[model samples]
Target: MTAAVDTRPDTAPRGIRRKARAYVALTKPRVMELLLVTTAPTMFLAQGGVPNLWLVAATLIGGALSAGSASAFNCYIDRDIDRIMKRTQGRPLVTGEVTDREALIFSYVVGVASIAWLALTVNLLSAALSLGAILFYVVVYTLWLKRRTPQNIVWGGIAGCMPVLIGWAAVTNDLSWAPVILFMVIFLWTPPHYWPLSMKYRDDYAAADVPMLSVVRGRSIVGLQVILYAWATVACSLLLVPVAGMGVVYTVVAAASGLWFIWEAHRLYSRAIQHVAEVRPMRVFHSSITYLTLLFVAVGIDPLLPF
Candidate 1:
């Protein structure tokens, strides 16, 4: 067989600050923060109280590191396509701020180190869950589905949905119904959140041949899907209060938030049907983020708030 070609390119002999920034860019901080937000509530909900201090800390740290590693590997894999997308053109890998060798080594080191910490300090179940998330993200989502199919995000959203499972397992060592419900909430939420961003960058995705919903289906169809997923997410979010044994405080907040989420989706559908710019879809996407964070935070604080 012929030797595999390394698609990785060279980087500059750079200053320390630039090098540091490249390493930081590999982690995709905003995405990691959002992932952690989901993790925190699962911990609290699992116990129906505040989570254990040490275990929560260990799991979050390990989860964040493993997430970063997988994200870095994604950058490595998508470097070429990223260069074609204006939105991702400045990414460290695309810009040659870091080499593929550097990224690969960094990803492997962080992934192994994070899993090792989880196995030793946290429970083995948590470690295995974290590793599974990484593998799903890197191997299934980034490497396989992304380039080949329009359904990539639909299937690959599983990796993003795993943090709640990890958090619950970290505490109870059991895969309870609560975390599974939480997974459903996030899984349904992913499409509406991402498709709008993809709509905003449809030309870039087309250039990269990435087969995003926005690139494959027309805007009308994708917008409808976003609305449908938005409705599903709201329905799933409402289930959290009863399923997780959250209080009336959580139920009230969820009902209110879910209403706003549905409103946003309706607005997006209206705009898309009219062939308006995707600004409304983008707004819905941002509001979806706020809705999830607020719903989960409400869940986390339910024990403190009187019903």
Candidate 2:
């Protein structure tokens, strides 16, 4: 499914200053901010507290560029449907802030630049992993999966999980069970984290004909799935305690915050079960972000503690 080339006049912004903001918006800054939150902490765990500042800086920049590259391509690819969805209606591409050609070119240029930067500044393996993530997001998830099935995000979420691996690999230049477990934690966490947002935006997806889980399934079914995945996410997070040799801080925070996340997930299900007029799934969505932040913060902090 090819997105039609945007022919709208480039009235995105007249000043160079204004145009930079439009390009940044193409990266979906909010999502990138969340993606970045996971990067350094994993590096911390890999290095056991502090890695070289230069290496850390390089990995974060590479990760950001890789992520931004993918998002730009996504903006280009989804330009047509983007206009139909209210949440995405004001996107630069939709508003003619950036032309399709510019978005497409920008995606490739920054994407290639990121790979080169990583390979030179970081390790080849980390760079390769970053490149793979870019390709998977553009080729597999965005192009093929997003519009095809209700299970789109379930598998497509693999791309989002790459930063953990990339961050770890950047430090160690190799793969191990620790990062893999953390990867699985994010993999499981994604569905529950995203489904609530999907639930809130179900109508928008429905109108756009995108088959996100909430659009295809009832709220009760989606809530049940959220609960199931929330449990799986918590289980996966605990594995880090042993696999990564994490200590008391991580163990306690993981266990406690996980229970709270599961409880919130249950609350969403309970509301759905009761056929409430409005099930506020955003509660779970926002909590999921906080849960992840706390879990990873502990991951970063545990290694620095004397205990």
Candidate 3:
């Protein structure tokens, strides 16, 4: 009877749990995971090897929470546009699972907490930078630039590039050429990384009245931009081997991955890129994920290699 009674108490809290889940969904967890991938490697490289476990944990939590805050706010602001896009139509706010007021409160609370956590455990520079990142993502990118121009992701790239710097600053508390290079890698990588996804959802952007490159520039023009950005990414990534003091292992890995990225970009370009097929653009999007993960991991593991 006691054992059975314990399980029955959940009926009262079930609604609360549902609401909690709805709020969590607003953070866009999958995107948070990718963002943290960059953060972890930047810290690892900054330390010239692995960092202290506690510090790494704190930085990751702060970065994730801050990113979540920015993302949640973006969701609320973009709720109208999201409702029109099938991919985001099922989101908590869009589906009425979560109220805008609740989401707004959650976003601000988390946003402030993230900054506080970083300031306490990491450094003021990191805290300031993290705050800047949130503002850039929420205000600069989402509110200001997204609907205004086709160069949305181009300048909006700054928000994503901030984590690498925050991670580096977490360990060293100072910015350096190494992290700057890493930042550039991601900054340049953003256009190609995101443009492919824009292609996948071009029609969605059009319907939602979002000025994504695929909508503004046409598939062929966007494809050309993708190729150009891929080339730029390759150039910047290759330069990191020497600048970051990466060993032969990292050099080989980055070179191979960079070449593959360029090849994919060319394939998209050479094909004329008119039709909205699922395979090609999705492939580019997935490949961009793989490319960044591999390059950052190579950097993280570089110091481990006997040189």
Q: Per-residue lDDT for 1-307 in model 2, tens only?
A: 9999999877745567677889999998888888888989999999998999899999999999999999999999999899999999999999998889989999999999999999999999999999999999999999999999999999999999999999999999999999999899999999999999999999999999999999988999999999999999999899888887889999999999999999999999999999998899999999999999999999999999977
Compare the candidates by lDDT and give the number of the best one.
2
Best by TM-score: 2
Candidate 1, residues 1-307, lDDT tens digits: the string is: 9999988654554577789889989999889999999898778878778878888899899989988998998999889898889999889998888999999999999999989998998789988999999999999999899989888898899999989998988888889777888899889988888888888888999998999988989878987898899888888877766776778888888889988987887887788889875455678779889988988888688866656
- Candidate numbers, best TM-score first, in rank order: 2, 3, 1
C-alpha lDDT of all candidate models, in order: 0.87, 0.94, 0.90
lDDT of 3 at 28: 89
- What is residue 152's positional error in candidate 1, in angstroms? 1.1
Q: C-alpha displacement of 248 in model 1, angstroms?
A: 1.1
Provide the lowest-lDDT 10-residue window in model 3. 1-10
**Candidate 2: Cα lDDT at 187:** 94
Let me know the TM-score candidate 2 reaches against the reference structure: 0.95
The TM-scores, one per candidate, come to 0.92, 0.95, 0.94
Q: How much lDDT does candidate 1 score? A: 0.87
The residue pairs that clash in candidate 3, if any, are none
Candidate 3, overall lDDT?
Answer: 0.90
Error of 1 at 213 (Å): 0.8
Q: How far in Å is the alpha carbon of 259 misplaced in model 1?
A: 1.4
